[model samples]
Target chain A: MRIAVQAESFDLGAEANAFAAGVAGAGAVVTFTGVVRDLPEGGLQAMEIEHYPGMTQKAITAIAEEATQRWGLCDLLVIHRYGRLAPGEAIMMVATAAAHRAAAFEAAEFLMDYLKSRAPFWKKEITTAGGDWVAAKDADEAALDRW
Target chain B: MMQVLYFAWVRERIGVPREAVETEAATVADLVADLIAREDRYAAAFADLSALRVALDQELAEFDAPLAGVREVAFFPPMTGG
Candidate 1:
């Protein structure tokens, strides 16, 4: 498993290629990327992501460990960016590999579900009006109940 | 001395990212009460417990969790990561 919490942008194609090439004897690989979305009015300027340094890594690692254990994944990669980002920029990505597509897809979704709420990062949306912290959605917390 | 940290609006409201707190509080709630009694900023930051979350020693924890042997404590709003 590889986990990265960085401020720099990543190349999606490059990352996916690397992950797929690194895995041995995996029949399937699934990748998911999260990108920043512009507000409907389109005045969104930037998104400032804040995170607890030590705890962010710890939390993500714990989540990844649980996913790998639960799904018996062949390999996993998670990269989440922190700091200012313009709308439409890639925010993060997760890739999972397994002998079968079902496990790969399921583990990838599980990782995303946990990362949405459990990770220690917070996002503040900056727009022409001002900046506002993005509120946690009730649906996000509810998403965990299915697993 | 316990290392207490704050994040997001909590840090903004508390006016600091972190501080070393000297306290005898037995639980996370007790420590919060001590902080709330310190000044208006803390009081305002901790006004509503339901909007907040806590981490003890770098792990997510409950407000009522005991602080025994804990070296670090963090208070912040619910995470909105992805």
Candidate 2:
């Protein structure tokens, strides 16, 4: 499993292909990319993500390990960005490779779930009123409990 | 010594990213109460524990669990992770 904490956007095709080829037992590679959406409808603006330097990456790596142990995943990659990000930019990516699509998909989802609830990251939304910290979403935490 | 972390609004209210405190907390809940009672800033930051989540050594944990030899504790709002 490969986990990355970076500020730059990534190419999904290259990452997916690499994961697919890396593991001989892998027959499927599933990925989920997160982009900054303008609004409920569609608009373009800016967003900022904050994270603790040493701690953030460590936390994510541990989450990836958990997913690997639980799902027997062959390969996994998690790339999350920090700092100011404009709309349409990729903020995070979770790619999982496994013997089948089910394990790959579950691993990807589990990675995301643990990352969301466990990692130490915060977001600020820029709006007409300037910028403010994003509130924690109950659904996100609840989603983890279900797993 | 236990390392404590504050995230998001909790960080803003507490005015620090992290703190190392010496404690003999019997449970996570007791530690929070001690922190809030330390000062107005802590009180304000931890005023609403309902919206907060506690993690013991980076894993999500319940409040009533014993602190024991825990080296790290973190407080943050419910996750909005994808």
Best candidate according to DockQ: 1
What digit string (tens of lDDT, one per residue) describes model 1 on residues A33-103? 99999888788999999999999999999999999999999999999999999989999999999999999
Please tell me which predicted candidate would have the highest lDDT against the true structure. 1
Report lDDT per candidate: 0.96, 0.82
Candidate 2 lDDT tens digits, B1-82: 9999887788889999898998777999999998987899989988888888888887778988789989889888765554
Show pairs that collide, candidate 1: none
Best candidate, TM-score-wise? 1
What is candidate 1's CA lDDT for residue B50?
Answer: 97
Report the lDDT tens digits of candidate 1 across residue range B1-82: 9999999999999999999999999999999999999899999999999999999999999998999999999999999999
Model 2 steric clash total: 0
Q: Where does candidate 2 stray beyond 4 Å?
A: A41-44, A52-55, B22-24
For every candidate in turn, the CA RMSD to the true structure comes to 0.7, 2.6
List the DockQ of the predictions in order. 0.95, 0.43
Q: Name the lDDT of candidate 2.
A: 0.82
- The TM-scores of all predictions, comma-separated, are 0.98, 0.84
